[model samples]
Target chain A: MNRRTFLKDAIVVITGAALPAAALEWLDPRQVLAENPQIRWAFLVDTHKCAGCGFCVKACKAENDIPYEASVTRTWIERYVVTQSGELLADSPQGGRDGFTSGSIDLPGGTRVSEEEIIRGFFVPKLCNHCASPPCVQVCPVGATYATPQGVVLVDRQWCIGCGYCIMGCPYGARFFHPVHKSVDKCTLCTHRLTRGDASACVEACPFGARQVGNLHDPNDPVTRAVVSERIGVLRDSYGSRPRVYYLGLSKEVH
Target chain B: MKEYVWRPMYVVVLIAALSLAVRFFLLPHDFGVHEGGYKYGYYRLGNIAEWESRPALFRSADDCGDCHRQSESLSASPHAFISCQNCHGPAAGHPEDPPTLAIDTGRDLCLRCHADLSYPAGGRDAVPGIDPLGHHPFRSCVGCHDPHHPRQEVQP
Candidate 1:
């Protein structure tokens, strides 16, 4: 074949092969856009009941195979104790998950203090709020993040350029930059497990049932029902992200 | 004859242009952020310097590990997203002669940001004040406030 004819054929073949891979790598727009979402609302962590067990934290790490070196966790729990005299105290001897404080990270003022102990101290787990207006998606120039019909904010890691804008923009400080890939990362709501009609890894792994996740659309789901029956509100109301996650009897005092 | 002469020169210029274009796109800006893993989180310990006029902005948590090797795992915290400066203030000039990097009294320092800023008008009114001197007489904010996680929903 002459140069023109040969070049045209080569271009077609190369682009044809690259197109599917790119889409799959970026985010399978067709597959994602086609599927019906299952999750609607989400669970909340009551800091009062948490015992600083770190079960959810460990479960999340083990379930997702999250590595401490770089693959930052999508969810983690922290320990806090309020003094009898009304002094708010923070302590995490075990990586800020459960009640233990074993692991060490290079953080400022990160050392755990063991002076005063209060029975009132509790563990609190934190994760992505899965906002109705997910800021991560809005700020992403490449359209890497999207919201599901069920209102879960999911990201197409393949398409993500790993920019940290989402990390900074999140009011709750839920997002993190992947150490190695240099891409942005956060809790996925366990879409892999949820798709299989299973509970979230964190929920399933949690021994205390501290985390409860279910379909907000399904009125029968306990989480959704409790939200309506109890009148729970979302976190950081000022953010106006309209988070899908709700808390039952969540205290207004703990902004 | 004219086409032959112009074609080679044109091709040479185009190739050079293409090479230059490659350099611009494949390098730092296109990749977004600096090269390699973010060092701010874990890996080591000690204080990191963030002087206003210094190039030490990107120094990670390892710099601070020198003194706080005990907190090496702090890099693993759930609140690892927070920078050293946000909690303990700046880590200017290593530990300094007299140790300026030490966390002074008051969780209010952190509350200034973490506190609910309801009334920007009455600055302190919106903030949940820490009665350091009156009640607990705590040394630092973390004394009671866990920076890694939000407090549990305190039910009425």
Candidate 2:
């Protein structure tokens, strides 16, 4: 064969082989473009019901298979202590996994206070808000993070480059680099659980029924009913992330 | 000289066009997410399938109720809305190979909600003021009230 024919034949074989292999590795375009999505899920957090038991944090770590490390929390509870002087103090030692002491705000090797100094305090649990207009999804360069049809935000671990852009963009400080997977990790809202008609781990773990996950599209859903009837607040509503997690009895002192 | 120069250029163009044809032929059939104005297909295309490979970590409460029907009494009480797993921990391994779940009988668990706070003394919150010291000092609240139906149980 002549040099030109040989070169031409070689290029064709390589291109033919690579195209299908590349296409198989990504999210299906059809699934992404499906119109008229019927599902819209939301998380309702009743801060009033939260007792700072920290069971939800422990449950989350166990369910998600996250390590028992302080820095890599997928969910954590914040005990907000607003003193009579109107000063706010918040902390979660070990994500409150071992639970919290009410009378004295005992942080891990940090601060301690007597009941005399405190006025009122409450616990606010934190996790991926799964924003409608998620900044994390927007910032992900590889399109690894995406919101599902049911409104759950998920990270495609295989596609993630571990750039941490999504982590930085998350206003709730939910996303973290996975120590084991070495991929960008955050709460999936437990999509695997939700899809099967089960509640998220944290929601199920809440002894007080403080946390709930439901489909906002379904009017009859208890969570949807509660969200509509109750005056709900989102974390940093001004940022316009449109967080799906709704909070009831959220103190003004909480951020 | 002209034949030699032009022939190689023609061959290069042919290969480039053939590569484009292969890519177009192999391109995914469905249009993916809509970007600004146009559609961009095949963006992270196989992720959905990949995600489906993992099993669910949490089981539905209904799964627990299927076998442990006695626990359904919680539905009639004030704690009706509370999930069983909330107190028993994740029942991920229940009914098949049951995992030993922790049962929280501690006062701290009960007091997280029952304990009074100065947050304007009840609007919608079911929280009632308790002195803990005066009402039942050094006593577990579960001693008197059932965790499921607090009002139904009488104080001993």
The numbered model that scores best in lDDT is 2
Cα-based lDDT for every prediction: 0.53, 0.73
DockQ of each: 0.02, 0.17
lDDT of 2 by residue, A55-161 (tens): 78877887888887646788888877766787777777777776664456665666776567777767888889988888888887766777765676778787789
- CAPRI category for model 1: incorrect
Off by over 4 Å in 2: A1-37, A106-109, B1-43, B71-82, B86-89, B98-156
Fnat scores for every prediction: 0.00, 0.20
What is the Å distance of residue A55 in model 2 from its true position? 2.2
Off by over 4 Å in 1: A1-41, A69-71, A91-95, A101-119, B1-156
**TM-score of candidate 1 on Cα atoms, chains taken together:** 0.50
Write one digit per residue (lDDT tens) for candidate 2, span B54-111. Answer: 5765667667767776555667777676667656655665566665655667776665
> On a 0 to 1 DockQ scale, where is model 1?
0.02
Model 1 root mean square deviation, Cα atoms: 18.1
Q: Give the TM-score of candidate 2.
A: 0.69
